[model samples]
Target: MTELQLTLEEKIGQMLICGFDGLTPNDHIQQLIEKHHIGGVIYFSRNYANVKQIADLSYELQQMNAASSQVPLFVSIDQEGGMVARIDNDEVTLVPGNMSIGASRDDELAYEAAVICAKELRQMGINVNFAPSLDINNNPKNPVIGVRSYGENADLVSELGIATIEGYQSSDLAATAKHFPGHGDTAVDSHYGLASVPHNQARLMKLELAPFIRAIQAGVDMIMTAHVMFPAFEPEQIPATLSRRVLHDLLRVQLAYEGIIITDCLEMHAISKEFGVAEGAVKAVEGGADIVLVSHTLQEQVAAIEALIGAVRSGRIQEEQIDVSVKRILALKHKRHVGEYEQLTGSVAEQFGTAERKDLIRQLTEKSITLVKDEQQLPLNLSEPTLVIWPEVRHHTQVDEPIVQAYTLGPALAELGANVKEFRIATHPTEEDIQSAIQLAAQYKQVVVVTYNAVSELHEGQVEIVRQIAARNDVALVVASTRNPYDLNQFSEVKTYLCCYENRPMTMSALAKVLTGQLKAQGKLPVTLSPEYSFGMAAQ
Candidate 1:
């Protein structure tokens, strides 16, 4: 497909990847394809049900697009695994998160995990994965991108990111190294408001921008722009997604990257609330973005495409510029054979979530679960009644999906045949909730507290609860951070601490085995906990 052959509307559509609310094709999605001529479709947790349902939907959408447009849709999903995963069902295989992979210090495991994810996505007809988040998670207070990142160290993140990119692309899936420049050193979540990394170019090169530079060298297929602002490079207060200095000058010219540059969803608050999605879309393309993603709202999708067309017609954006982006997009689709449509035979593959994949997940989890410290509480006494205080199931951040059936510490402990009494606390526990939990701990001989991102001030109530519980001399206390490892920084008094990286089912199960003496804690810390407990500190 040549750029000269496409009409203005068609070219505009080719740069868009929109999302609609449905398990199957609806009028809104059809209109985006037939009327708007969108280039791709993005899948969230809402759009998925099971393997067969989503697979069928992918096949049908491809057929639908084939009838009207010559270009094939880039069916993409944020299957970054762990907390940010969109596809989670009984039929699909799940792997340990990036932080966990980093903890294991095994680049082979990282490669294998991505290979598994790519194969599953390919079977479902998903050609692109917004994965291998190369963000260096240096800020513990960051509401988003905590465990989703590889680690705090630039070299570890770079090596593992390169492994993931190779794994995905080797399987014929386009791998996207995301949140360009970096999104690691921020406190604010871009989903809610504008966040900035205030470091100079020298500091960014040393830490934040290290992984992306390595990724470009490794020939990453796509680089997704961050909604984060970099004051050192980009003079304007606008995000890197709309800053030509950041995307074009820094990423394209300086780094010499020549791949597809896709923007993170324009509907995110950093773009949507600050600049309207329509205007943001226009500015994104002008800033050298190859694809502008509007993941929600039909109105925004339509308006953004219309705004792009208007910009072209009014000479605000030159037609020649549009040609460059479209050419890159088409060249990638052709290389990946993304336009080829093939229907599933009304059945899923036997290898989707086989025991082999399940065992890999188990091995990865066993290798990743870290015992940050253990003074005397090595193994729990299963003979006596144990109290498990866990945070109630909920979304930890705006990026995390609302979990339908979250695997908790209580159930994991129970599966190991422990005499367990479970107590649920609000994610952000209140004074009343804390008081009740403290009082409840008096009844059990052993107390285990599972925290979810307690390092963040939003969940500071958890730290207070753990401190009060630890002060009690009667019950032996244990603290485990299920999401972020930085929780140990908050309550250093707790002698027994474990870092699970994420609260996924595999992590919870592996943690259960570690607590019961069935598995050993061999995983090291991927990120620095504190001055005393630095990176690689773990009690084996």
Candidate 2:
């Protein structure tokens, strides 16, 4: 009877889904389910070892869910390719990104991209994909959510973002359009710090809200709120994540979004620095969020859930409000066919680097790779050895080492029979290292400095490396800027700049193709980079 003993607090706790870390589901997780009956869990790349491993974990998670018959669990992952993807498709398959798709303006590609993402994730026993970032990256200095967005134009963002959702919906995976009203307009990364966009309701509606509205109309399963302030809308101390006006009135009543209203990670800085994590979860739920997300840090999840239960018991939140979220979670779970999807892995693993995928990747990457400033020194007469200086971004705490197998690209480049010199530039390069790069730049007929925003700090060491090389020689800088073109300002002397939009294999292959003249730079700058690198700055 003690096992069956219940409280409204515990019932409310069951409706709030959260995430866990590591490979195995721990006793802490099991206790949360069997005791408090937490509603859901979000998976990350770290929780996965391979396809088979995830299938087994999904099975176990479901088994735990069965212990309580309130509702099925909400299982999710970040499968958005480009800068913020989780699944490892062996470096063969990928989508170029929302920006690339938007630049192409091909609705067909949008459907194809979404279908591919959905199908692959579905095959691995995944039920949800936090994708189709509905942010409009009009702000050039935004530390996060750059090329992850579709483009700067609101109308285009609306069009392509909706198309992406339809594509995901086609394959029966619950697709989420996230960081509502929008996160792309902010100049800060919410992961490490709080961010705000000083836009009025008029500006937000015209720019940021366009994509989310379009996505909702196209049958999005959920809308994830941003942890950003909307003073003109809320007009006070409330971010969209904890604002009833932003979530219910604007999104639900006005935009007519009938789907689940999920909040972004409760642990993120924008929320956490304000109220502690526990109170933040309650605030998000009270703000018209159907599901409060306590993502990241298992310890925080425990504390937040406890706090939520306490709040509900104390009557700070009504019991019916908790039921409302659980009902939404159940509805999404059933619609997603979480119980019916085949438990097969590696069915399409061989599809990576397939002719079709490669072709699409090549095509999309060529379109996305922006040529902001070039000396017109491209189509380089590289009959001679070009000193290729490669920069390593984060020191490897890599999980995909053995599965990544041997280095694929470096050796493959050798087969192309190009004399490529490699340099490993860490996060911070000393003056001696700068001189070495300078000296090397003098010797080579063309110095190709390959850089990316995804791996390295956009404004840190790479800038120093590029500036030093450009100063010394007529450098043919092949900038592999995966996200922001903001880095271009620091390297004005770069003879040829390429925006590969993503650092994934798709974008990588495109960069290689364009470098070898197998392809041409066709992408317009999707966002403004000042008057110098404005939208459509590249050659027509």
User: RMSD for each model, in Å, please?
Assistant: 1.5, 3.8
Structural similarity to truth (TM-score) of each candidate: 0.97, 0.90
Highest lDDT: give the candidate number: 1
Model 1 clash count equals 0
Q: lDDT for every model? A: 0.89, 0.70
Candidate 2 residues lying further than 4 Å off, grouped into runs, are 1-14, 89-92, 345-359, 395-415, 427-432, 454-458, 473-478
lDDT of 2 by residue, 1-540 (tens): 111243565556555677777677887667667776776778877788776677778777777777674455667887777656666666435676787776666767777777777766666667778887889888777767877888888887888788778888889888899889899878777766667778888888888887787787678998898888878778777788989888888988989888999888888777888787888888877778887777666677777777777777789888777776666666677777666744454644473346776566556556766666666667555476667665444533211111231332333344455676655554345566566876776777766666655233533666777776666544455555645556676666666777656555556556666666666767777777668777656753
Worst 10 residues of 1 by lDDT: 393-402
